[model samples]
Target chain A: MVTEIFFKEFHTPNNGIFLRIKDSLIKTRSKFQEIWVVETEGFGKMLLLDGKVMLTEEDEHIYHEMITHPGLSLLPEGMRVLVIGGGDGGTVREVLKHNPASVTLVEIDELVIEVSKKFFPSLAGSFNDPRVKIIIGDGVKFVKEAKDSGFDAIVIDSTDPEGPALALFSMEFYRAAKKILTQNSFIVTQSESPFYNKQFIVELLKNLKSEFRYVKNYIASVPTYPAIWSFTYASDSLELDVPPKRKISPTKYYHPNMGLDTTKEIVDEVFGCS
Target chain B: MVTEIFFKEFHTPNNGIFLRIKDSLIKTRSKFQEIWVVETEGFGKMLLLDGKVMLTEEDEHIYHEMITHPGLSLLPEGMRVLVIGGGDGGTVREVLKHNPASVTLVEIDELVIEVSKKFFPSLAGSFNDPRVKIIIGDGVKFVKEAKDSGFDAIVIDSTDPEGPALALFSMEFYRAAKKILTQNSFIVTQSESPFYNKQFIVELLKNLKSEFRYVKNYIASVPTYPAIWSFTYASDSLELDVPPKRKISPTKYYHPNMGLDTTKEIVDEVFGCS
Candidate 1:
């Protein structure tokens, strides 16, 4: 039986990559962006927001674990955390592994959360945890109004620095985020790709250094992302060398050793003494 | 006025990626595969062989320098080296940086050499150096019949472990290569992506281990490849940690520190104690 398959294309700014899809399970345009979940051949289920791939079932662990665990691992146990624009719930799932005191996920789009709950059960299931507080509002506005000296860590799992997510990358947003973060706290965010987004990464790193005492850029080679993705971690009073006492179980991609080594090696390449 | 542009697509086995090409400068069917030279917007010029991208002007230095330098750095001055199937001459260019006594580059296809010389002048110009000897023949037969205990390094710069290059990844090939290497000689070859070609990497690693005492796997995040490309470094009696005294000048990517750090970090992640 030779049956042909259709490919679902995800366009990058200059170049693009595509995945082979068996069927499109869900496709709808929300007030914020277009959302789709499709069953793929080798990559398993893929989630797309605004025609850009956010995660695939096979390799989501790389991005989710890298963004959440590295920054959170620097803090003590039972820490309060904030996640901005991670409506898909993968961030929340990784956060639960740390046994946080409470996790507040501030997503602006209600439909993104609703669609994820229906289509991505494995990721969205963490929402039912009693420690999670889901808020449907702009992350920028919410950070400004949130009480100061609260969260121990903040994970910005937003989309690319474009459109609605543009403000999230600005210095003003980082200042607001700093106001709410407890001393010795850190915030980790997806910067962009080094090959495609070098300028954006440079400006973001510079801006982060202006607001934080210690700012470092880390990198991960995610298959789905199809490029060397850059991540930014900023801390005012905390040292990020401390390893996590807790275990991250059932992970396909990350180990504590791999994470720390990646951070150290990439930090040197991006901001080395030489 | 708004304008529309066409994209030049390069399809992988199961999926694909595309770039915005200003024009397809050259296209021809070589004896072994199809060849292309395209001018891309973001990635400079791109070279495609058999419908798969071989290298781009933007990031080819990452792969070429990593493969050639780390292995060559271990040897003393004025050493003899052999390169199997590097038709493009990029590997030879990096090998010259160490001031080797002589480099014998054995490529199977003459057309590939000719095409690269015509289109990729910066890469193929190194062939005119007094130290290089270009041979157009079979690399498999070349290794099997080569003299024993003469060369300080052997670099297998063939394509993926398929088609004519299949023998380059076999146990028989490594056994043949092992016979000709000097006591402290090393061999470095490109393994495929960890995400898409895990089985191939595992099998190749196992084969190399049977023949060599110290077999290490290293990875580099190359943008055009779009996957974390792995490279295998195998040596009979040498430890790869020794740094190079010679300076690699006019290099955009490779520094001694960056190279060592990349090798260390990737070696741990790929073959870590944990």
Candidate 2:
């Protein structure tokens, strides 16, 4: 009898999701984390960093569009964007949709980029765009030393607040990030799940609020992640509770009037602030 | 050494969610299905029917509120309401918040009601309200034999379209349900997950559209369920796209201007309609 292989990622020590693996496509150790590409019966191909799901072919669009559009749609066209830790290139693909003049992707792990180029060409295809630039370095260091007031938007598409991505969630990184962003620019970060990562989100929001004049949280449902994935939008001058300034075409989930303001009350209720 | 126990519910044969059991509170086989109540590490107490998760203490509000308030809040206060297969009383509890003149709950299984009253008191507490009339019978028969245009609203809180709940998702059931609803009345049903149950939802929406003039879909994120859960609202005279006619207080998720129209576009995209 043949044994079946399954990939299990524990959200907590006791609870988690499991997918039936049809084949193990690739497995390797990167400098920062363990990287694995597995073909699954339910979600097609999935990429895991440190054994935690980074993105899956089935539901990556939800997470990618949510992290990119809400902030980018509010800004003018021909903007400059900087993406942190999205080595898979999904965020850059979405940023390219908004007609950005330039996009600089800072990914610490070069193996992730290489693996995506081989396995997930649809995502990695964005790297070939003339406007896009790839920076093989730590995002925190790039933000610290980069020219001031350079980018119109900064999208932190990092992993959970751990490993190399831990510093991306810190206050000091936000400060350095602020120095590199143009006036009226916005920074959006994947803020973990609203249900499972409440404490992390509460702390992240507090730090963002301290640095930005207008900080708001929005959510999208990503099945591969811990259900209700959240993103935090922070800016000093941009209004967070307005409709999209322009229409984003070819979107499966994100819509212009998709109730961005509804999340404020939900954030307050989840944190017991209201 | 002690062996650990966990409860697993598969959305598909290849994918599923698992929760560690802190304690097995209750386990028994009912005439209709297997009933199990287990104390979980992540979602507090959970009620399972036939090894499938029915509800969890941590996220039941999201499901119950989305299924109940969106339809009930659109109608006037003190309206007559009918709930089908909601033996747990959670839907009845949300319906009472709308100040319904009377509520008639028809559930096929009596054991579910007894178990809910014993273990899920917060949800079962609505049974004690004076306006509620519990009918221990099949929902399908009740809807068939009931007088024409009797109730102002009908909320279908049955399980997925399988086994004992299979008939509830049929076109005959929707046709019969429409006959029992008064003019300008609304009928809402839990339509399952958009990601995992796309084919089911497409068929359900088609049946609903064939029976009602206005049919719309709405979504809420319930972490315990399959991420994004869907609900469909159907009406003959009432507009399904308008805002909630009244406020629903003590809600953790639903808001009046929560962009009900957004789901229509999502439904179109998911089913490849537009």
Compare the candidates by lDDT and give the number of the best one.
2
Q: Estimate, for each residue in B1-274, the C-alpha lDDT of model 2 and write its tens digit.
A: 4337877777877888888888988999888999999999868899999888899998888789889887888789989999999999899999999999999999999999999999999999999999999999999999999999899999999998888789999998888988888897999988898777777887787788887888887778887787578989889888864356787777776666566643434567444553
Residue B63: error of model 2 in Å?
Answer: 0.7
Against the native chain B, what TM-score does each candidate's chain B reach?
Answer: 0.90, 0.94
Expressed as tens digits, the lDDT of each residue in A1-274 for candidate 1 is 4225745453455676766778889999988888888888777888888878889887787788878877787677799999998888999999998889999999999998998898888899999999999999999999999999999999999999999999999999999999999987999998887666777877887788899988867667777784778778899887554345555655555555443323223344456543
lDDT of each: 0.79, 0.86
Predicted candidate 2, C-alpha RMSD: 2.4
The numbered model that scores best in DockQ is 2
- Go through the candidates in order and give the C-alpha RMSD of each one to the true structure: 3.8, 2.4
Per-candidate TM-scores read: 0.87, 0.94
TM-score for candidate 1, please give it. 0.87
